[model samples]
Target: MASIYDFEAETLDGRPAPLSAYKGQVVLIVNTASKCGFTRQYEGLEALHRRYRDRGLVVLGFPCNQFGQQEPGDAAEIASFCALTYDVDFPMMRKIDVNGPKAHPLYAYLKKAKKGVLGTEAVKWNFTKFLVDRDGQVVGRFAPTVEPKALEGAIEALL
Candidate 1:
C-alpha cells in the first residue's frame, strides 16, 4: 500500500512540495476555500499548527474551488487572503480539484484510504479534512463542518 509520503504537491508559490518532507509527522490535510462559510476555520487550523507543530503536528491547507467556486482566486490572491485575514502560517498548497477526473492525486489517495460518511469516496464539500498519523497512515476523515478544535484530542493522541 502507498503511504502519504508517496505523494507530492505544489506550493502556493508554484514550488515543488513533496510529501516525503513531512514524513513521520502527524499531518492534518484540509481542503480550503476563502469564500466558504467555513473559511473561518483557517484560524482554528492555524492555532492547531502553532500549538502542536513543535510536537510534530503539521497542518496543510489545499485551496479547492470545486465547491460553489468558493476559492475562485489565483494563487497570489489565495495566499494574500490567508495571510492577511487568518494569519495562516502553515503550508498552503496550490489550488487543486478534490473530485472529478482532474482531481489531485493526493486527494484520490486520501479518499480511497478514508472514505467519508456512508462509505462515500467523494468529498462532499470544501474544508473536508484528512488526518494522517506519524507513519503516513490515513487515520481519520472529517467533514467540512467538523471544527478543527474538535480534533485536538485525536492529534494529541497521535503526537
Candidate 2:
C-alpha cells in the first residue's frame, strides 16, 4: 500500500521535491500547460491555494508538454509565465511526461488510483487534477474541464 507520500519529483528549479514533505496536508496535484486554452485555470488554482492554504490545502502544479505540445517552454519560462500571467504561487514542478513510459512515477500511481472516463488509465489532456487526502491517499481525479473553484467543497471535506 503505497501512499502518495512515497513518491518524489523535481521542482521547477530542478530540486528534489518529496511528497512526504506534504504529509498531513490535503493536496491537489494538477498537470498544467502554459499555452493551452485551460492555462487560465492557473488563476483559479492559485485562488484555491490562497483561500484554503491555512485550512490544510496545497495546490501543486506540474507542467507537461505531452498533450499537443501545449507546454513547450523550459522550466524558467514556465515559471515566469505562471507568475506573470496567473500570479500562481502554488508549488510548480518540473515538466515531465504524464502519459507514457517516461511518465512521472507519482502520476503513474495517481492514474492507477483513480481512472478517468470509461476507466481509462491514460490522462486525456493537461490540467487533469488528482486530489490527495491528509493521509496521503489519492481521493479523487478531476478532468481538465473541472474548475479549481469547484473543488472547494471536496477540499473542505478533507480539511
Estimated TM-score for each candidate:
0.99, 0.98
lDDT of 2: 0.94
Sequence-dependent TM-score of model 1 = 0.99
Taking every candidate in turn, the Cα RMSD to the unseen true structure, in Å, is 0.5, 0.6
Model 2 per-residue lDDT tens digits across residues 1-159: 899899998999999999999999999999999989998999999999999999889999999999999999999999999999888899999999989999999999999999999999999999999999999998999999999999999999999
Candidate 2 wrong stretches, greater than 4 Å: none
The candidate 2 region of ten consecutive residues with least summed lDDT is 81-90
Query: On residues 85-121, what C-alpha lDDT tens digit does candidate 1 reach at each position?
Result: 9999999999999999999999999999999888999
Q: lDDT winner among the candidates?
A: 1
Clashes of each: 0, 0
Error of 2 at 21 (Å): 0.2
